[model samples]
Target: MDIRPTDRPDRRTFAIISHPDAGKTTLTEKLLLFGGAIRAAGEVKARGAARRARSDWMKIEQQRGISVTSSVMTFERDGLTFNLLDTPGHEDFSEDTYRTLTAVDSAVMVIDAARGIEAQTRKLFEVCRMRSVPIITFVNKVDREGREPFALLDEIADQLALDVSPMNWPIGMGGQFEGLYDLEHDRLMRPAADNARGFEGDVEQLGGMDDAKLATLISSQGLALLREEAELAQAGYAPFDDTAYRHGDLTPVYFGSALKDFGVAELIDALARFAPSPRPQPADPAPISPDDANVTGFIFKVQANMNPMHRDRVAFMRLCSGKFRRGMKLNQMGTGKAIAVHSPILFFAREREVADEAFPGDIIGIPNHGTLRVGDTLTDGPPVTITGLPNFAPEILRRVALKDPTKTKQLRKALDDLAEEGIIQVFYPSIGGQWIVGVVGQLQLEVLISRLEVEYKVDAVLEPSPWDTARWISAATPEELKAFTDLHRGALAEDRDGAPVFMARDTWELGYVSDRNRAIRFSATKERN
Candidate 1:
C-alpha cells in the first residue's frame, strides 16, 4: 500500500464544532494524543500543575478558557493525513467558525451530553447543512450524569431535523459508567479503571452479546436497557446510510467522555474510515476536482499576528486539488497575476513550520504582506473563483480613533490587516477620511482593540455609533450605484474591501431606503465576488 500524503483516499480534512463549554477543546486534544501529534493531552482549564489545551494558543483564550479563533492542526496517523480544524465554540466567534467550515469536507459536531443541542451548535450545524458537509456527532461528557442516550438522540433528530444513527451505545452512566458497546461490530468496550488518561488502563473488550462478563460490568436492568436500545437502533430506528451522511441528511452518533479520554480513539478511527476526502469545490466556471493536475486552493482565513513578537500576517489556504510545492508560481485569481509562494507554512496551533510540499485536502499558510485576502483563489491552471463564503452584516457599529495621532499610518495598516481577517469590518464614510468599525458582537471589537495594542503597538478607542445594522448595496450598473450613493450619502459607507454599504439606524430606515431606491438591492449577507 502506498502511504503518501498525495494519496487522496487517505486524507481527512474536517472541523470540530460545538457550543461553549461543550468540551470541544478537550476532545480535540485527545484526538491529537491518539494521533501521536502531542505527547500528552492538555486540560482546557488547568488547575495548579496541568497544562492548558494546545489548540487554544492565544493568551486571551488561555485567560478566558474559551477559543476565540480557529486553529488548524495536521497530524498523520495510520498512513492518513488528518487536517483537524479546531474552531471557536463561543457564539461571538461563530463567524470565524463559519468560515473555517467552508474549507473542510466534513464536520465533527461535539454536543454536551447534559445540554444536548445548543444555540451555537445549531447555528454551526445549519451552515454545515447548507454546504452539504457530512457530519459526525459525538456526545461528550458522558462520564458525568446527563441526559439519557435515547433522549439525546431524539432531541438531535427533532431539533436539527436529521436522521440519528447510534454507532455505539454506552454501557452505564455517571457513577456506574463502565464503557460503550460498539453496535457496528457487536463488542463491549469496558475501561479497566475509572478516570483513565491517554489510552491508559487496558480496555477490556468483550465479544458476543452472550458473554458472561457483560452481566458483571452492567447490572441486569442496565444490560436489558442496552440490549433493547441497541436492537431498536440496529433494527431501523437509525440505520447508517452513507449516501444520506454524505448529503448531510444522516449523522452517526457516538457516546464518549472526552475528559477521561475514553471513546476518543474510537471516534478518530471512525472518522478515518468514513469521513469524506477532499471533494469537488464550487468554483466560478464550474466545480474544481481534487484530482485535477493543476494546483488550486483558496484563502478561507487570514490571521494578523500569530506571533506577537514578529508582527506578521498569514493567509491560510486550503489545497483543493493537485500538489503545492514551495517556490512554485501560481496565479492569484483575484488579481490574475503570477506569484511565487515563498514560505508555505503549516500550523499546529500557535506553532508553525515551513513545508516543502502539500497536497489536496491539506492546509498551508503563506506569509503574506497585503497580497492575499480572504476568498482569493490561487491556481496553476485557469483563474477561477471559489464561491460560498458569506460575509454577514455587522450588528454593532462604532467609530474608532487612535490615541497617538503620529501613529495614524500604523493604526490604519493594523486595522486593514485585522479587517482582512474578518475580525471587524472597516468602513469609510461616503465623504471619506473618518473610519468606522463594525462587528457582529462586542467581543469582536474587543479582540480588534487587543490585537492593535499587542501586535501593532497602537492604542485605540471606540465610540458607540447609532447605526445598528449594515448592508452592502448592489445595482445593475455603475451609474445606478452612484445615483443611489449620492441619494443616501449620509447613510452610505465603503467596507474595507471597497464594497459600497448602507448603514441604517433601524429596520424602518432600511425599509425606507429599500422602498425609496427601487433600483438598488440591499443585501444583508454578500458572497465573495
Candidate 2:
C-alpha cells in the first residue's frame, strides 16, 4: 500500500466511536492487530478493569481508563492504508469527539451487544450525521454471556434511525459461539479456538437456520459475493450520499467478538475490499493563492512539556495547504504580524517525537513558536481568517480563587495558558475581583486545580462562578441612540425582560484568537465641519 501524500492515495480514514465500556478500545486493538498496525495489542489496565481502546499516551487517561482525547493511527492491509482515529466515548470529552468527526471521512460505530445503543453512542452518531460522515456498524462483545447480536442491531437501527442490514451473522453466541456465517459468502470459517480473535465464530453450519438469508447467500454465490462486498467495501461510508446504499457502496453491518478475535480474517477481507481510499467529493478550488510565497497551516492543539533542556510548548498543526519549511516568514491568521517558522515538524508517537515534512491531512508538532494559538492560520498568502471550528459552548461554569498572594502571578499565568489551550475560558466580572473560569465539566476543573498546586506551586480554592447582570443606561434623545449604535458596530439586539438588550463582541469568540499580540483596533471618528 502506498502511504504517500497523493491526491488519490489508496487510504481509508475512519474513526471508531462508542459509549465507554462498549468494547470500542478492544475492537480497535483487534482491528489494528489484524491490519498490522501494531505487532501486539496492549490493554488499558485501569483500577480493576482492563480497557483496550486507550492507545499509547498514558497521562490522565490511564487512571480514568477512558479516552480523553482522540488518537490517530495508520495501518496497512491488502494494498490499502487505513487511517483510523480512536475517539473518546465519554460525554465529558464530547467536544473532542465532535471536532474529530469533522476530520475523518468515515466512522465505525461500535455497539456493545449486551448494552445495545447507548446515550453516548446516540450522541456521537448524531455528530457524524451532522457532518455527513457515513458510518459502518460493528456489533462487538458477542463472546460475552447475554450479548444478543440480532436484538442489538435492531436496537441500534431504531435508536440511531438507520436502514440496517446484516453482512455477516454470528452462528452461535457465548460459549456456543464457534464463529460466524458470512451471509454474502454462504460459507463459514471456524475461528482459531486457542488464539481467540474478534467476531470469529466456528462456521459449524452455514446453510443451517435462517433459510431465506441462506438462499440469498447461495444465489449471490462465491464470486458474486466477493464482488458485491468488494464494491461496498471500496466505497466506505458517505454520510451525505443516498445513492451509496442503493448501489451497495457502503458497508452494511459486520458482527464479531473483539476479545476472542472471532472472524478477524473475514473482517480483514471486508476492510480490504470496502474501506475507501482518498474518498472524493465536490472540489472547492484551493484557497492558497498562486502568488502566496509562504507556507500556511492552522494550529489544532498544544502540549506543555517539562523537559530538561527547555520545558517546551509543543503545538499540533495541520498543514491545510501550501509548502512550509524551516525559517519561512509568515503571518498569524488573526493578528497579521510577521512570525518566523522554526524547526523540523514532529509527529507524536505516544509521547515520543518523529520528525517529518507535513502535508495536508498530516498532524505534526512544532516547538518554540510562541503566541501561536488554536485556530490561528499561518500563511504567506493574502491575510485570511479561518473560524467556525467545532468549539462547544461552556455548559459547566466554575471559578477558582488564589489561596496564596505570592502565587497570584503563577496562578494567573496558568489560567492564561489553559485558556490558550482551549481547555477553559477565564472570566472576570465586576462584582468581585475574583477569578472565574468555565469548562466542559468538573473533571477538567479538577485537573486545572491539581496542575496549579503541583505543577505551578499555586494553591487555589475553586467555587462555582456566579452569574451577574449589569444595568444598561440609554438616553431618550435620538442623538444618544445613534451614538450607541455607532459605538457597537457588530452589536446584536434581543428582547430581555420586555426590553431590548444589546450585546457586543462575545468573550467566547475572543478565545478562538487568543494568540493575537494586540487586539484589532478600529475607530469611527468624523471631523465636525
Candidate 3:
C-alpha cells in the first residue's frame, strides 16, 4: 500500500496531564474556549446555578470538583480537528490516566508555577518519556504570585531531564503581571484586565530591543528585568527543534494563567502549527499506518452509565487508521467475530452526537452491549492485537456480596460491567466461587459501591479480605501449571477476565510460595497477547 505525507495533516491527538489542583481542567476549558467549542468557559468550582466545567460531567466530579475519570473532547480550529484527552489529576486515579496516555500521540503537561514539579506530575512525565511521546509544558497560574520564570524552566530541565525552549517570555508575575512577549514574532501581548475567561486581548508590535512603550507599560524596573532575562534566555536556552520534540528530547514551554484566560491562544496556535498528526500504531504481526485502507482502532476506555436517564455503556475507541463509518463492519480482535458498529458517537464532554464518519486521531464512542472491553482492538482487516495495556496488581482486597439475594443476576451483571471498565478487579475463589474484588485504593471501592447503588440500583457490602497482595501465575507447561495449582489449590482464584491469580495472606506466605514453587513465575502485572 502506498502511503503519502500530509495524508492526515488536519488531525492532532494529545492529552492534558497534571497534579491535582494544578489547573489541568481549567486549561482544558480555556483551550475549548479558544477553539469556539463552548460559548462561555465555566469554572471548575461554580456556585448555585453557575455552570461547571463542561469536561467534568459526572455527578461525583461535579460535586467534588475533581476529575476521577478521563474525558475525551474534540474540537475544530483553523481547519484542524483536535482530540483533547483530559486525564484524571487525582493520584488515586492514576491508573486510568496511564491508560489514557497510551492512546494519545503527545501530551500537554500543566505545572503550577508556585508548586513547580509535583509527585503525580513526575510519575506522568516518566510514562510520557517511556513512550517517547512529545510534551508541551505550560507553566500555569502566573497571574498569581509564583516562582520566577527562569527558576521554573530550570526545575523542568533539571527534574524532567528535558531540554527546555521558552517560546514566549512572561512580562511580570503575580500582582504585577503585565502580559507576555512573543519571542518568535517580536510582539508584546497585553492582556486586558477584565478579559478573564474571555478571548479578547491586545497586542503591540515591538520594533526593537529599546522600545519606549515597553518601559511605560511594565514600568522602568520591570522592563529592565524583562530585557535582561530575555537576552539571557535567547543566548543560552536551546531553540525549539521539531526533530527533538518529535523524539521527546525537547519541550516547548509557554507561560500562562488558565483561570484568567491569558496566553492560552498562543499555546493553541503553537500546537496547530507544529504538533504531529496521527502516526502509525504498533500492533501485533505488524504496525498499522494511518494511510491503511482498512479501518482499525482500539478501545482504551469503557464507561458505563454516562447518562443517568439511560443506563447505557459507551466504549471510547481511538481511530488509528482509515475512515470509520456509522455502520461499518469490523473484526473484534479479542473475539475474532465480525460486528457492525451502528452507533458511532462524537463527544463534547457528556453531550454526544452520532458521527457519520470519522478519521484518524478521532475518538468515537460505540454503544456497547457486554461485547467490548478495555484494550480490545477492532479492524476491518485481519485480526491484529495492540499490546501494552496493563492489568496492574491490586493492593486492596474486599469480599463483596449483594444485599438482596433475589437481585443476584443484577449484582453479577453490574460487577461484570464495572470490572470490564477497569474500575475494579473482580475475582472468584476456586472453592465456593465467592466474589472478591481487588482495587488499587479504597477510593475505587467507594466509587464502585456508589456507582452500583446509583446507576445499577444494586446495594452491596464489602468485607475485608485477609490477603495483602495478589499475583498472576505463569507456567512453562501444562503439567507445571497443573502441579502448581494442585499444590496451592485453596489459594488459587480467577480474575475478572478468568486469568489465574494467587492471593497471599502476607509477605511471609508469598515468600513461602515462591520458595516452594520454583518453576512458576509470579507477576505483578498481566500483558495481553
Candidate 4:
C-alpha cells in the first residue's frame, strides 16, 4: 500500500438554492458556462433553460419548467475544482433539497431582484442555518425592474439575521440601468451595445468607488444615486469578513442578472475566492474532516434511471476526506458489505463521464443496483457514520390507483425504485390491499405520476388516501412494539424499510392516538442509521 499525505487540492462543494422562478437553474447554467463546462446557455423557458443541454433533464421537469430533482455538476476554475449541486428550488421537493444540503459545505442563495426573499428561500435558508452552512447571496435579475438594492439588503439582514456585505452595487436599475460598480475589485461592467454575444458585456478598470470614469458610464441622475447607494452600503454593512462569513454569520452579496450574464463571472469568482472548502462534516460518533487520511463518504442521494438507455441507478456520494481511486472496495456501513466501485461518475448535469479518481469536496456517483441508499456511509478505513439527514413526515398521502391492474408487478417495481431514490415514500398497510404513497408536498404527487409513466412505464393514478398523515411508531422493546402494532393493526402500516408507521385521518386523530399510547413513540421524522 502506498502512503498518501493529508494535504490535497482545494475544492469547493456547494449547492445553489432559491425559491422557484428565482433563476436558480439559470444561474446554475450560467455558472457552468463560466466554468467551461457547457458551450451555450440554451433556450429560456420561464426562468430556466429548456434546451436539452440544460440541467433540468427529467421529462416532467422540462414539461413543468421547474427543477424537481437536484442535479450535480463538477467544473474547474483556475486551479480549484468546484462541485456544484444545483438543488430543486420548489418547496415541494424541499425534502430532496434538504438532503442535498447535507452534502454541501456551502450554499449560494439566489434572490430574485424583483421579489427579494421568498417562502421556499427562507425554508432552505433555515436549514442552512441549522447546519451552519456558509452562504453567498446572489441578487439575480438586476438588469430588470426590481426593488431598491438597499431595501433588499435590509430585508435580508432583518429577516435572515445575517450580516450582509455588498461586494458590488448596481449603478442603476430598470430602464436607466447602466452597469455594476464592483466595490470589492474596483471594476465597472456595462451592457455592450454593439459586438456583443449572449449576455456578454464590456468591463472597465476603476480606482475604487470615487473613480472619475463613473461619470462617463452613468448619467448625472444615475451617478448621484450610485454614489449615495454605494457609500451607504459600504458604511452601513460590515465589510466582507472572511472569518464571519466562514462561520456562517456574514454573507457577501453580489448583484447580477443571471439571464443577462451581468455579475455571473464575479459571482463565480466570489465562490472560488471566499467559499469555504470542504469542512468538517457532522457524523454520529464524530465530525469528519477533509484532511482525514481515510477515505470517507456518505450517500446523500440515489437517482434511478438517469440515462434511459442504461437504466442504471446512481448514488451521489460526497467525498468527505482522502482521495478515492477507481475500483476501491469500501465497506458499506449499513449492510456491513464491502462493495467494489468500478465506474465512478463525475457529473455535468445530465452529461456524465467516468471519474478515474476524486478528492475531498468532490461529489462522485457510484453506479449500483439495490446496494447503496441515502444516508448510508462508506469508508475504506475505520467505521464511522455521517449523520444529519432525516426523512420528514409527509403532508400528503395517496393510494396507488393502477389503471391497468394486470401490471401490478410493474407498479410494485416502479414504486420501490422511486422510493429508493427518495422521490416518494411508500407505505404498506398491514390490513389494506392498497399501497399508500407519501410525499412531503403536492408537486411530488405530480412528479410521482410523471416518473411512473415516463421512466417506469407504469400507468398509475394517485387518488387521495383515507389517511392525511403518517407517523413512524417505535417502542422500547420489540414485544411492546408488536403489542402496539397488534392493537392498531388496521391503522398501522410499514414503510419500505418495514418500519411500523401509524396512519391517521387528521392531526386530532394523531393526537388522540398519541395521548393513549404514551409508551409508544410516534415519530414525525425518521433518521436512517
Identify the candidate with maximal TM-score. 4
TM-score of 1: 0.94
Query: For each candidate, what TM-score against the reference?
Result: 0.94, 0.70, 0.95, 0.96
Model 1 clash pairs are: none
> Candidate 4: lDDT of 422?
93
Q: By lDDT, who's the top model here?
A: 4
Tens-digit lDDT string for candidate 4 (4-88): 4654547888999999999998899888888776667753222244434577999998898999999998878899898999999
- Model 4: how far is 123 from its true place, Å? 0.2
lDDT of 1 at 516: 85
The deviation in Å at residue 34 for candidate 3 is: 0.6
Candidate 4, clashing residue pairs?
A: none
Where is model 4 more than 4 Å wrong at Cα? 1-4, 43-52, 194-199
Model 1 local distance difference test score: 0.85
The alpha-carbon lDDT assigned to residue 93 of candidate 1 equals: 82
Residue-level error in angstroms, candidate 1, position 526: 2.4
Number of clashing residue pairs, candidate 1: 0
